[model samples]
Target: MSTATATPEGALPHRDLSHTPWRVLVLGATSGIAEATARIWAREGANIFLVARNADRINAVAADLRVRGAAYVETAVADLDDIDGHTALLGRAITALGGLDVAYLAVGILGEQPRAEQDTTHALHILHTNLTAPVSLLTWLSNYCVNQGFGTLAVLSSVAGERGRKSNYVYGASKAGLTAFLGGLRNRVDREGVHVLTIKPGPVRTSMTTGMKGSEKFADPDKVAREIARAIDKKQDVLYTPFQWRPIMAVIRAIPERIFKKLNL
Candidate 1:
């Protein structure tokens, strides 16, 4: 009953979409990195479905993509936190696209550590948003991809997930869960010809971190977007934005637990 495509190249970078126009769905389309990626896809004349909570924001993004020479652009506004809506939302996305070639999930939140530590409610919301919701959506999408047999799935995890830091362990724990999920999902689906990419971005200068200082190490979303496009074209398994975060996190994870805990992150 699977309608999966037997394409060896997967949805992305298996072939150039410059002329063929692959269909792409961008979840959390309003995020800075997602917005930048959508623009890159637009330049290749890809058809895109933008999903986000804000209708007006998604509309503006759609207009920009249309103007950028996207073959087709549409919007589906919904808060990604609503796990119950994922099935209907993804169903609508694939239906609008006619079929799905690639889906980029770029939804998450940076909850306040202080608040999370003080209140179980705050902690649970962060966990649900970053871990539970994405898991639910990815499970659905993975099944769809398996049955369809052709697609690329990329998710935005965080380098903070590499190892839990005291400052943002709640956020870190969520991403850590997501990262593990992606790894398992990738193993299960790759043989079926689906590309599952786990993207870990370090500090990013965006609306979420606007007021936070110490952004000197933050990667530019535009630059990060371009790199992501290249990685997709190559059908990569894991990508660390700006290419430097990999080693940075590697060293951090390599430290002994006793030593790591003693040092301030």
Candidate 2:
């Protein structure tokens, strides 16, 4: 049985979350980019529900958001990879928030490329967390939003997904799949008044890219978060953070396979 709230059909487009006191749900609330984005919403006095696997980290995040001026902050500790629990978890979140306005999905992993190449288990783990789990959550969320006729689904994909490079093809593939999924989901739900945003960010100064080469050149998370906040208000369909990544990925995609495979990415 579905637990989603129902509303009158043919409602108008959702009001932008830029309005103060938005009811928001942040999955993977402990991630650097996610936490930074939540902080922006917090300053607007948004009501938030945080979900993540780490109890200590999630609790700290909730506390910080409250201090940052969020009107309300609630949290639940749960591993999002457990697809079986998504429905119940989302139900609780919606209840806590009084209703749903925006859901930011910032859950993903960058598995060791060499290890993934040798171990199917490692590769599958990456795919499961980055792809399958998100699909499950989106399926439930999209339906709920469709029934109510309003919501924004902002998801984190990666510029790496634009074209696969030998360096981290496994992670790239997962993001590529997610990007495609978001595209199709937008096509299906846009007419129903649900906005689906695919956020393709280049490497940012986050824990995920902490030890990587050229880490000093990565984009700042705070700046990226600001763009994201604006994009949601504008209801953009796709966002390339740092903006330069849009052209950079275009060039990479335009390269022919014969010449591309020879050059290191």
Q: Where is model 2 more than 4 Å wrong at Cα?
A: 1-20
> Model 1: C-alpha RMSD to truth?
4.1
Writing each residue's lDDT as its tens digit, candidate 1 over 89-161 gives 7887887887778899998889899999999999999999889888887888887777667678999999989
Tell me each candidate's TM-score: 0.92, 0.94
Deviating ranges (above 4 Å) for candidate 1: 1-19
Query: What is candidate 1's CA lDDT for residue 220?
Result: 87
How well does candidate 1 match the true structure in TM-score terms? 0.92
Please, what are the lDDT tens digits per residue for candidate 2 over residues 146-255?
Answer: 88788999999999888888999999999999999999999999998999999999999999999989999999999999999899989999999999999988989999
Candidate 2 Cα deviation (angstroms), residue 137: 0.4
Please estimate how well model 2 matches the true structure, expressed as its whole-model Cα lDDT. Answer: 0.91
